[model samples]
Target: MIKARDALTKIKPYVPGKPIEEVKRELGLDDVIKLASNENPYGPSKKALEIIDSYLTNLNLYPDGRAFELKTALSNYYQVQEEEIIVGNGSDEVIKLLSEAYLNPGDNIVQADVTFSEYEFGALLMGAKVKKVPLKDFTHDLEAFYNYIDDNTKLIYICNPNNPTGTMVTEVELIEFLEKIPKGVLVVLDEAYAEYVADTSYPNSLGLINKYPLVVLRTFSKIYGLAGLRVGFGIAQKEIIANLEKAREPFNVNLLGQVAAVRALDDKEHLEYSFRENAKARESFYQECQKRDIKYVKSHTNFVLMQVEDADTIFNKMLKKGVIVRSGSVFGLNRFIRVTLGSIEQMQRFWQVFDEIGG
Candidate 1:
């Protein structure tokens, strides 16, 4: 019998949140709420839906491989050169592209232990080794990250407002870390939830593109509520962008995604509304945790990572109660869970059920 490469053994697949329909059917219940996966609970901006509806007729044609119009829009929005932008099916594609383009077997990728799992996934696909550095106090320890880099280190992933922890590395610390890293090593700063950051100290990662050989990734999946549409992009130096583009499929991003993302960028009102609601919900949730004496990391982004004894049990209980949050076991934090801050009403409902369970 044929067998796969040895590296396949190192790869653990990503398990996303179950669909609400699947959950309801399994539990035989109705009115399920999913706060898992950090999806925007407000749903997509109306303008995005309207534009996508208008573009439905064009679905028969292949999407623009270059994604020129969307890239142009992104360039104007971020004040970056058009050549520096590359659109993807989502940031997941971008991550895969970076690994494919840069990593060689036996090379190394580095990230905090309990952060987004994709960085290690990308490494394993390319037969590279992952050096897991433990986070400091639920945040990325910039010093440890820099210390881990060596001649064999090809990639270092910084998930700002990190997944499962909902904590961030500040701008000053990131700038210093970037400066200290070797020029040959690529820094992929995955700012997937950046739009929800209310903190003034989070690095403006795009600004670093011109100064260093860094790639800053963003997604419409979060605040723009386009996760279902699968739109995300990366900003890097022209040389680095060219390398990643080589690994990209001819039409990785679909027609609907381009249309939706363009309209979503223009919907400033929707953007502001989502940000405001997320900030408020984050505060309220923190207060709830405080009152209950539940330990949680203070978040600048749209989610909270709270410690509960037997998170698996609490997660199962919440599921049965028609609410769903992410168990942190996937990120190697078995005692914690990540809850996405949703609309005021949805958040209130989540807390209500949570109180009942914890009480």
Candidate 2:
């Protein structure tokens, strides 16, 4: 029998939120509002859907290994050269490619303690040491992270508008932090929820790559409503993107996802509508929390991190009500639960159930 690498032991499989159909079956309820995975409730761009259907009969052909058109679209959108962009199956895969390109048995990676889980997962996959610095006030502590850097630290991930907590590090703060980073280390700015961030304080992360060896990742899964398509891209200086491309598989992204993503890029109307709806819904969540005097981290992304006592029980109860939310024990914040923003009607329904369960 073949032996698997010992590194596999350190990797924990990601747990995705339960699908709507599964909840309906398990809870015996037909009505379900899924607010767990931070999906765009406004749905995908209509233009993207049309392109997907048009490309259906072309499934027999292999996808473009370089994902040329999608990369071109991304380059145009982000104002980066084509050589500096790398499309991946998802930003999750982009993280994995970075790990493959940089990490080794003796190397290490640093990240916020409570941000996206993929950074650690990718580090472990490459036999790299994982160093986690705790958050300061539910936000990335750049000073603490800087302290963690050593010669062995090869990569650092900053999940701006961070996951689960839904907090952020501002542009001014990020610029200061980037200046202090060692020249040998690569910084990955994972801005998976950037479009939802109405905060002017948020950095234009893609532009930062000009001065730093920064890899900025964006995903179609969130604001573009293409989560099911699994399309995401990363932008960096030409050299870094080239290195990542070496680790990326040929045809990493499917043909349909490529065409859909290109069309999605042109759907300005859908982008505006999704952004507006999410902002309005997220604000309503803030009002509900304020009315009940419940503590929650004010979010810049499409989610709210609520501090409810007995979070584990609350999670289960909310699940029974067919309102799916993420319990922060997943990120080691056991007293907090993260709720993804849905449509206004869905948010209203969630509050109705939330009020019944003592807020």
Candidate 3:
């Protein structure tokens, strides 16, 4: 019999949002609303879906291992070279590749205490330690992060418009923080929710990737509405891409995901529509919170983290009412709950049940 590695014991697998069908079955309700994962409630661009449908007959062929067409499309859109881009199965895979390429035993990765869990899991998988600096006032504390860096720090993960909290580090703060860090340490800026950001204060992370030797991860999963296709890409210096390439499995991304991502990039109208809808609904959500006298964090992304005492109780209650929102206890923030912003009608429905429950 074989046992798992000691490092594997330190890692906990990620738990994604439950499917709507599962919730409906569990609660015995027909009107279930899922606002847990920050999925684009509008769904994918019709053109992208059509393109994917057209390519289904060719599933017998292996995917373009290099994802040439998709890389070229992303390169053209971002004004970066194709050589500087590396497409991933998802941005999740890119994080794992970065850890595989850079971390050695006992090295450390630094990130905010309650940001995305994948970064910590990536480091732990590589037999490395994670140094998490606590967030300040529900936001990334750049000064605190800078203070904690040491010689053994191999990477720093910055999730702009951070997960769970939906708070962002400002452009000014990010620029100053970048300048203070040394060259050898790679900064992985995860902007999976960047497209939903309406706040001008958020950092222009792509610009930093060009200026410094940083890696910027973006995904088709959010505003592009391609999460089911599992498409995402990273932009970095040519050397960084070359290093990460060593860890990638050829044909890691599927043919359908590549085709969908390429077409989605061309659908400017769909992209704009998602942006506008998220911004509008976010304001309404904030107003609803105000009306209820509930304390909530103002968000730059497509989700809001609202504070509630007995969050577990509220989560279970919401589920019983056919609404699925995330309980933040997994991130160790027991007092907070994260809800994805949706269309006006969907969000209005959420608040309706919220009001009925006297929450």
Question: Which residue segments of model 2 deviate by more than 4 Å?
Answer: none
Worst 10 residues of 3 by lDDT: 204-213
For model 3, the local distance difference test gives: 0.90
lDDT of 2 by residue, 76-172 (tens): 8778899999999989999999999999997999999888998999999989999999999999999899889999999999998899888999999
- What CA RMSD would you report for each candidate? 1.1, 1.2, 1.2
Quote the positional error of residue 237 for candidate 2 in Å.
0.8
List the candidates' TM-scores in order. 0.98, 0.97, 0.97
In model 3, which runs have C-alpha deviations exceeding 4 angstroms?
Answer: none
lDDT of 1 by residue, 176-212 (tens): 9988899789999999989888778989888889898
Candidate 2 at residue 91, lDDT?
93
Using alpha carbons, what is the TM-score of model 3?
Answer: 0.97
Please state the error at residue 123 of candidate 3 in Å.
0.6
User: What is the alpha-carbon lDDT for the whole of candidate 1?
Assistant: 0.90
RMSD (CA, Å), candidate 2 to true, equals 1.2
